[model samples]
Target chain A: MSDTTDLPAPSLDVEGWTCPAPLRDRPRVVMGHGGGGALSAELVQQIFAPSYGGEALSQMGDAAVLSLGGARLAFSTDSYVVRPLFFPGGSIGDLAVNGTVNDLAMSGARAAYLSCGFILEEGVELDTVTRVAEALGAAARTAGVEVATGDTKVVEAGHGDGIYLNTAGIGVVPAGVDLRPQRVVPGDVVIVSGAIGVHGVAIMSVREGLEFGVEIESDCAALGGLVEAMLAVTPDLHVLRDPTRGGLAASLNEIAAASGAGVVIRERDVPVPPAVANACAILGLDPMYIANEGKLVAFVPREHADAVLAAMRAHPLGTDAAIIGEAVDSHPGMLVARTGLGGTRVVDLPLGEQLPRIC
Target chain B: MSDTTDLPAPSLDVEGWTCPAPLRDRPRVVMGHGGGGALSAELVQQIFAPSYGGEALSQMGDAAVLSLGGARLAFSTDSYVVRPLFFPGGSIGDLAVNGTVNDLAMSGARAAYLSCGFILEEGVELDTVTRVAEALGAAARTAGVEVATGDTKVVEAGHGDGIYLNTAGIGVVPAGVDLRPQRVVPGDVVIVSGAIGVHGVAIMSVREGLEFGVEIESDCAALGGLVEAMLAVTPDLHVLRDPTRGGLAASLNEIAAASGAGVVIRERDVPVPPAVANACAILGLDPMYIANEGKLVAFVPREHADAVLAAMRAHPLGTDAAIIGEAVDSHPGMLVARTGLGGTRVVDLPLGEQLPRIC
Candidate 1:
């Protein structure tokens, strides 16, 4: 008689039988699956998109713009799992509010209400919870949105970290405003709201106990007002992105791939703070792949580039706005940066983030 | 001079300095804070309500009803942290979709779109994630709602359980259909759809490894269709509640307190399946306090109760629907149950759930 028990269980041989187009080589979820990079996109496209089987989710915008009851609505959700709940300039509470708000703003919508879901760990101090709650309330007020509804759940002490918050927001899209990657044209001008890599460096400084001479605080703020200011210049803006998890490079790559266009930026023109650059050099990380919370990358019509930049500069949140790139007819679905030494280099989408939990 | 190093830090004196009305005696969050009972209500009223500072949240309904761009919208959110991601008859995926759908239905709205947020623990099997996603997609299709947008984040292996899902739904409330606690009045009949205690019992069976003669599956389902049938009988439903987390007892106590009315139910009229009853009896748990995911407790006008009951009976989800109680003018803000032995007893809101992570 054959020894059946000695053989591998049928379920254990999942790789041998199951189709692996979506999951590819990995049979287990890794940090990269949530890092908003190539793996993240693959997971969404192969698994989530096919499973959902809906046009709305397939749009893959920062927020889904939908028409309901004759109203144009923007809906989005984001979960905050950043370690060290309290950072230099903000906390998870602020990100919980601002992150979703910025997502709606990316679709040219004015966020109106937010739904907060909190998962708390058992035995976490009440004062700690209160502090986080207070910060969230303050951030919502500052963003001009209401925390209208909420749900709370708790897990056993070891089963959860101190707190993980998920915020889903709803907003109203203006009558004539439409922002999507497909709107990009070859002559479009690309503008960035401010310096990159500050938020990521600030987080690393705290988590790794590495400090430069100057204090680097997170650039965490709601960008609804900044977007409104840009829209005031002209609602004909092509696209907008918050450049979060996978940073500027991921945003550019996604836009290029979605729109089937080429994105070119001048490396000398891309603003990077001295402290952030020093920190990245020491850590052997690229600033292009570091995350940012309170910044936006916009593709606008060439005719309105200067006017939009001027308006963004007038807004308090966008004082550092700069036009650093333009869409190109060549190299479709690719991002290229012109080095300071006058050489062109492809800036590919990151395979994973340099640091996890930098959001 | 006495050594000052032994003195306690001022921050440690949270009990002595901070106003204690909201937090009351507890210095840290307990499992009860997420139990959907007295502690949950206290957390909302004292902490979340004040922090939010808005009237929409004060309604304390299953969903927040709001007017956006001349369209009446109902928005609600819930986080599912049930242990053992998969259970009999349902999984967290099913609950993630149906729970939010039912919340909107309670407000007389037809859910249109849902936002799903997933916090996955790193190293979880890809097949497991795929199964959960497939279940979520199937449930959304069955509920006739679209999963429009989603966000995913991963925590380190030990920092989380297998998976935690949060779903937020948006729906449009039909015109002239206004449901709220204040609309409830004396002589209003309370009706319960199907049986209670099945879901909780099923979870306990797996967790405790206790086997009954018959398998008791969770009563988890989407109630939008059953609710639509009920509304055809009368557009004016005083209030509706899904008996989840804290079960029928908690739902009744909340309605009684919110509407400032007395609730009286005949214990024999409350439906409890034999298998569930047997499991609960062996486990020393009360059927009234056990959770039911696929059931609802609704208060309707007595004049329309018979028609509503008929409508409910014709639907697949409400086959066992029955009128179990009525609101009374005397003993406001209390729930009283008449036992089978011809005695009345006060059914107070549970301090916490009889079982944690029941939903």
Candidate 2:
């Protein structure tokens, strides 16, 4: 793991083990379980077991563990609160699942089970809740995992911000997995997971006032498969990072600081569809620092960059994957991007409020 | 554990357990760890070990198991938020630790370690935060457990309802432990850990508009010792319950319903300090349903009732402990109280609201 990567490829065999218990067909989530009493046990016993993926996890115990086979595990948690509930690509439920799973992948580990805690507003439609949860189950299945166990609490309308989803993930980083920002050497190459600003632009277009009529759907999808492809080909990945809230620029700057290395990104090498670029221009927003729900940045050793990118772009999820920059020792702990005209500037964390609650 | 009769007994041994790594002097919690990142590791490294108790708990794993030599385990999570942060006799910090410990104790489990999560509003006074945290540490020490690994997140101001505290506990109920509601037999006796309503009234007195001066203070202290005392005297205790939110009345109703039995209470046998009664009268509040942060209600076998009560009263923390009622098959699933006037009526879970979030 190095400073410039967001999604790293690491080998892991999470198979064979399975949870035999099945999910009960409860009409909907009842208040009893959330009340911290008996009903909660039934939910855990029935619904939780089927989706949990393993007997160890289905034990209804407090936490989870991964048999990393003597590997260091990467763990991460993210809470999703994307408004408009339903979106072009997915809902908050699915997003929550993929987002945390992707985070662990970025750490060069095989993502396993996740703990989901949902804070739902009291009046949310039961159908809507079921749909979102089903979406989560579907996404978890697609990524070869399970919903496992969860906690659902409904707050009196105002106290809750509609729906808040907290997802914590555990991934096993294999024995030979070496990932860190500090691995970003002077000549390391940077690769973009796909089109950089599509996800962010798509979100902005749906905002109350920034209504855009174009087909700008968020590129939100689980990246574990794509990462698996890359790892199958190369395990010596540098740093993998999801360019979430602060986007590409923030991601780059953080990597630089973390690795104590300098980063040089070429604006020309970055891929941005005309519609996304145009939308960013119209909205006066920098695509580099916008939030991207389904994207990650990776810094890899230069010699293996082409092979890694080729492995990535072969997957449908990474058709637009491309090399964006290289890591250097100069400007240590900072990032300098060469604009279209070769002009360089620094990218930093947001100075003030930039669409608060975007995450 | 039974509905209210099974009082917890502390383990006499504390040897041959896995010790955790040394603690770090982490000054403040960083954001990345809360992101489910490596920073979270730093937190676990620096803060968890020293304060953490129990071999199974110190591994910093998801959940721990007790050798109990085969004791059934009871787990519970509680979040504490008391305005003014500190009240007379106890602070939210102490209350947070004690509250869950008691819940686990009530379930007949000898509490081992606690996992605490703090949601700190940004820009909170450093001194205040540290003090509150230190108080938590000190109390855990007194209770003979480690704080264990904890998660801390600094939400932007106003996002929090003050410094919120969530503590999840792990305890082992000895092999023969069977404290479930069903054990509330017809002649079982009910014993309280101490006086009730004192905690709720103390908070009210400190709050604005309900201002009244008296020597009344919170009775918020861990009841593990007292539980152990009673449990040692009588292992046949049937049920153990903490009368928290909705207070004694709500707790009684819940127990009655859970055990599919009825409970009869004698008003004269209940213990209520004169000051708490006066404050409730002045505020037009009912002392019966007011919360008690530190007390518990225990139901013991008739043969052991006197011995358990004597043992409870012998502990300083349970000086006011008293036998207040008897469980019965009559009035199935209801709580009937014989008032001072010799009349009995139903006491049930409030139809709607009854002092929300008292703990």
Candidate 3:
């Protein structure tokens, strides 16, 4: 009846879907799956981990800690697709560099070399690519890493938006430093490097044409130096996370799940820049759930918390560092906030990030 | 005149163009630039190397050889944008794995780990994505490498064509087995692992709806094991190359340019399958310019040539291997082909590949 003989048969066996079949629900990829939230985590754990089974994957860290020829190395990769290639304070180039560098730094590793892959659309200007390259080179200099090997591929117009960058970094983790979420304990103090929600707001302003009188620059910078400074004070730092997509709320929830520990933070003590707060108010956005680029959250032993804070404050990138929370023994695998009005509320990880591709 | 008061100034300083300014006349990217030809080389040497300057980049090879903690490592990356997603015998996933693994293998390195970065379109089917992941996992297992770390990004609809995959690999180069184009000498013999033009013809057949009675499978297999097989016979292999994108003609030209020597290949001796020859005749395509994935071209000393060829022919993947040419001292930095008609023709690198996205 439908000329079925002319049509081809289906390729895949849809009846046998098992990995994350029930949890994901959607048969098509949604924007939120790339938002770095519960969907992102589920996609990673259920789909990717099961497909690519390896011992190193069992340990969930910012970068894979690999033993190669009697040396410890950290390898991590991140893709940058932030719209409006150039934002207020940084462009996609610097974001690509800082993002991968921050990932390696989260493992207390000093990034040494990086590999960059570029996917460009046809008709993209050569001058724009050159400018992006210049920005990338400058950022690599600041991060103390070399862009060693790279690849470039182009798609026909309409298949891409200007360019997308993927940077994979290799770094050496110092011998004494052993950092992971599993090391978090009940007596650990929670510290944030600086104010949250600046990077996301900066991108939103330009893309949405919502200027807030004063220009909001992205807090995009390499945190390798700041991380090294903290490690100098103590190599026993328990956990380090960069609140990029889904912001600090997602980071806290991830740590709680990974470490199987309870986390409680004081809302008033969390630093939110005045401009960011105003932007969030206008956007009806919660600052805690917005993304950050250069900031980091650290969980350290209570005994070394004061010293770590002092060391972080001494660094230029961490001048606004503040201790806002602590790991708790009760209510394991949960995160809560002490509200400004003397109330407590659960801060659960969203099914998906409020904003997508903030990085 | 045009209500331009609210518009901001352009960001990049186009007036300050320096690297290969006059040579690369085009200000916009064309498909040919990514065709693995002279334009691609010019883009990398002029634009990327100058921006990301380092001593390591001065040595151009399939991969960058780095010394870290007294261990020699080979690092390389490749991006796949092949259309149709799936072909006769291989998909983009296997191409992604085998391509990077081959790059490391060309450097006489055994690939150990890989990092995959996927850029997915917003509405891409999850089933398609799952199938790709499964193919990738299967390929990694076959290559004896692990997909250690990965990143995924989703773009809005109309901004992407299904998906693009980028893989960066790390491998350990065995001691005393140095491989580089500069090491090629006048007396070296040129040996190709198998027949040429199968991969390009396979992809073209599907894209153009050409039927040769029988489906031509893509020769997309990992070459790390093949390289190891050759190394077992002799560690003195001078140079190795996989003729992907630009084919054997491009590879010969590049080797000549890098070694500053002349190459002479016999047309009759170069193995071309009958089906590929027929397809080329129908399409008016040069078999020499077509791409290959699994085949490799090796330059070995005259004394060790027989042993290496024997080893290659003994392997299942290289049963059709043959010695097609030899390096010559005349006409340095040029490639000459001896035709079946008993005449010689100059083989220069094309401005771009005859077929784009054949990989």
Q: Is the docking of candidate 2 incorrect, acceptable, medium or high quality?
A: incorrect
DockQ of each: 0.50, 0.02, 0.43
What range of 10 consecutive residues in model 2 chain A has the weakest lDDT sum?
A9-18
Model 3 misplaced stretches (Cα beyond 4 Å): A1-24, B1-23
Better of 1 and 3 by lDDT: 1
- Candidates ranked by DockQ, best first? 1, 3, 2
Per-residue lDDT for A248 in model 1?
A: 95
The TM-scores, one per candidate, come to: 0.94, 0.62, 0.94
Better of 1 and 3 by DockQ: 1
Candidate 3, CAPRI quality class derived from DockQ? acceptable
Each candidate's lDDT (Cα)?
A: 0.87, 0.62, 0.85
lDDT tens digits, residues A12-87, model 2?
A: 1011011112113222222122211122333434432332213333312112222322334444555555666776
What's every prediction's RMSD, in angstroms?
A: 5.4, 17.3, 5.8
lDDT tens digits by residue: candidate 3, B1-359 = 13452232221111221122232456677666677767678778878888886876666677888887567888888888898799988999999999999999999999998988888887677778888888889999999999888888877767878888999898888999899989999999999999999999999899989997678999999999889999999999999999998789888899999999899999999999999999989877788888899999999999999999999999988899999999999989999999999999998776666666765
lDDT, candidate 3, A1-359, per-residue tens: 24552232221111121122344456667666677776677778778788875887667677888887666888888888889999999999999999999999999998888988888877787888888988999999998999888888877767888988999988889988888989999989999999998999899899989987688999999999999999999899998999998789989999999899999999999999888889988877788888899999999999999999999999999999999999999899999999999999988776565666677
**Span of ten consecutive residues with least summed lDDT in model 1 chain B:** B9-18
